[model samples]
Target: MTSSTRNRLFALGALLVAGAGLAYVAFGNIGQNLVFYWTPGEMLAQGSKAYGPTIRLGGVVQPGSLRWDAAHTHLSFRVADTDQPGAPSVPVLSSETPPQMFRERIGVVVEGTFDRSQTFTSSRLMVNHSNEYRPPKPGDGPDKWKTTVSAPTAEAR
Candidate 1:
């Protein structure tokens, strides 16, 4: 109605109810979908604060730290702040097959949870890639459809 008092009170009540619904939604479930991205160093610095939430850990895959199970079904690797050997590293375990582009000393981003034991259990693995297209090797033979397998190079990574 055009009545100002009733209109104002109804607006205030609706605002309060909407706010409460948002808060309830946040507390009940939306929090799980709120993924945060962090580097190995930043995650390590969070200590206990970093555990339990789904996180997208972005960093370089540590060279010589990648291991695959005999069946190749499980993969374990350490991610570092940089390609440097001694940078802060976060141990990751993934049951999912890694992207075809997965390799050591390359940029990668893994999504999963950081458990209390200090290891990140990844449900997803992704390799960081360049945005521009570069010519393939001069004599390189036909690969797997350019290995449309998400295989990438370290040029712009």
Candidate 2:
């Protein structure tokens, strides 16, 4: 074989090895890194298998189950796959203060570990929101925020 053919063969072998390494990593036991989040029902379905490893729990906030102390430092709420009352729910306790937009019936993802006790202790709390934005109408007032912004007084002018 000519020098060029030998070099090409060596390059092909290197490429194949690199590809195999990547495949192993992508398909390997790195489950925790690739998984984004699991729905509440899915997590619950895991049964005993879901007890360890920090995982993201994604679901809707269960209405009437959200509670926060007066200081608002700690929060507790139930998450379900949907806003319906009958959906499977998982109780979650979080130390992080909720975002301003967090509310019942909204999508949320909490990252934490679930114990055999059936409670999820979350270290981080995130509120999911749509990327779409619709600005207020041209003449719309501060009512959009449910607050009043008084116009500049004539006396000050």
Candidate 3:
């Protein structure tokens, strides 16, 4: 081919190589950076492939399922997948102290990996809160509730 034609072909090949490099950098080994979150039901559905990397499992803390070790301050509880209603439970083991909002029937988010024993070795624990809150009215200041409601004076009438 002529010199100009050769230059054009080289430019096209360089562009193709750059595009492929970009694609590999973006999509290659994506699993290493992915922090997946799923419920107990989803994890169970994933079968044995759910282990290895870190993950998040959320569900309500089953009542009477908590077993605390006072010596080590380690706590274990079963998190039932609310989606399945009465589905099988997944156990969570945490060495950290649970949040104050944590209680039976309360939602919890556990971050860790699930082993073959179905036990989630959590590195982080978070307790979900209800969406209910009482705020003061517009006219009511921060200390308005503390103010006494006095009767109107005769002159003011």
lDDT of 3 by residue, 1-157 (tens): 9999999999999999999999887889865546455778878888889978788988888766766664636778889876345766798999777765565678888998898887999989988777977777788775652332121121112
Q: Tell me the spans in candidate 2 whose CA falls farther than 4 Å from its real position.
A: 1-34, 135-157
Instruction: For candidate 3, give the lDDT of residue 16.
Output: 95
For residue 115, what is the lDDT in candidate 2?
96
Global lDDT scores for all candidate models: 0.80, 0.82, 0.75
Give the Å shift of residue 50 in candidate 3: 0.2
As for candidate 1, its clashing pairs are: 144-147
lDDT of 2 at 143: 59
Better-scoring candidate (lDDT), 1 or 2: 2
The number of residue pairs in model 1 that clash at the backbone is: 1
Model 3 reaches what TM-score against the true structure?
0.59
- Tell me the tens digit of each residue's lDDT in model 1 across 62-108: 97777766565777889999998789999999888776667777788
- lDDT by residue (1-157, candidate 2, tens digit) is 9999999999999999999999988887787546689988989998999999999999998877777655657778899999998999999999997766676788999999999999999999999987867767888853543231122121112
